[model samples]
Target: MIMSTIFPEADVTEGLKSAMRLYASGVTVITAGQGAGRRGLTATAFTSVTMDPPTVLVCVNRNGQAHDAIVENGHFCVNVLCEEARDVAESFAGMTGKTGADQFEGFEWIETRVGAPAYAFAQAAVACKLTQTLETASHSIFIGEVCEAATNPDRTPLLHFNRGFHAIGALK
Candidate 1:
């Protein structure tokens, strides 16, 4: 015998957002472009997709200022924030009312091999060349092939959960 289930018609937008708030994720700043055209945004929707070819993906809202820059520049760097970089994350997230290149001020940055601006103090920086892009209802999924990577093993990653920042600790 087979069984079937019925679903409710309730809108899932708010529910989905609330649910995701409980999920802890490393914070990252996705940066692209160069010079005055540089753009960046704080994002948690990023993940590694494959290791063989070294690929990763990040979801950026279509309305974000960095979205078009990333597409046009054809490169981006995912700067994984260290626990001490909360201010940088806030600036990029628009909490500081900074826009465009202004958000990059007061911080040290390095131009990645692929030409994306990467935070100098990031725990890890993955520079990539844009390989593919998938557009969904409100965001674009950018798949990139890693071109260069740098890491600082001493730094602990910053995380986001329950609408706030957090740090990880060993369970033992």
Candidate 2:
């Protein structure tokens, strides 16, 4: 099957972005750093890399503040947002006017054994140690070896589609 039949030679950026919006993905916060240096950003470019080693991959914007810390510290957490965590997602995505440590102010967080902080009330979370990294065009692909993980099965996951937040309904 062809992924894209129309290859725009003009501006592929807009074409690619619009095509990707057709896929529904879960919202997550890619967090790094500690204490006063903590930083995070909302991302939907996350996925399981492997099951045997319990690995995962998250694509982080290279220009984000937490990008450098994640590379320097060699650790990060993927906090899967629940439907009710839309505010947290917005804050981390810089849509709430909160930046740096201020984004974490009202949220309850718990530090994992690996030193990355996970959301206390997220739909799910994964603490990972950076095992590999690759620089793409505009983002860093972090391959993490999952050290710890948690999930709240009762909560519905928050999703992103067409540049909007959505709640996944349970299937009967």
Candidate 3:
């Protein structure tokens, strides 16, 4: 049922990534835990699965600390970023020389009732409790039941397209 005209003439990894890069996806920082155990990862692979029970899913690298924390803590917060939060994305993505506690150094965060960090500046922050997980290849698809969601309507979301962050207003 695949319907794409572009055939891979080179390496599949590069081909697939290049193809997917053409998609503009919202940026979110998946955060879990607090204090020294705090961990977050920059993710573009998050989306809603259902609305009746308010469920969502996010994919995480199987070996990432944030993935481990989400499992151990049984909760996570998806902090959807604004354009100004690109450095926040980079820090969580390990571009900065910071990890764990150091990665969260200067940001003002509000810990949710589920015990996960929700960024004050995020366009939207969703607190969720992990409900299920499916492991496939190198990543785990975590299914979560949303407990609470908040948004800053005045702030525009940050999106990733062609491997760079773009503000949402460029299109609509």
| Candidate no. 1 TM-score | 0.91
CA deviation > 4 Å runs, candidate 1:
1-9, 169-172
Error of 1 at 123 (Å): 0.4
TM-score for all models, in order of appearance = 0.91, 0.92, 0.91
Clashing pairs in 2: none
lDDT by candidate, in order shown = 0.92, 0.90, 0.90
Ranking by lDDT: 1, 3, 2
Model 1 alpha-carbon miss at residue 115, Å: 0.3
Model 3 residue 17 distance off true place after TM-score fit, in angstroms: 0.6
Please give the lDDT score for candidate 2.
Answer: 0.90
Query: Count of backbone clashes for each model?
Result: 0, 0, 0
lDDT of 2 by residue, 1-172 (tens): 8675676788787888888887788999988889988889999989999999999999988988889879988999999999999999999989999998789989999998788889999989999999999998999999999999999999988988888888875321
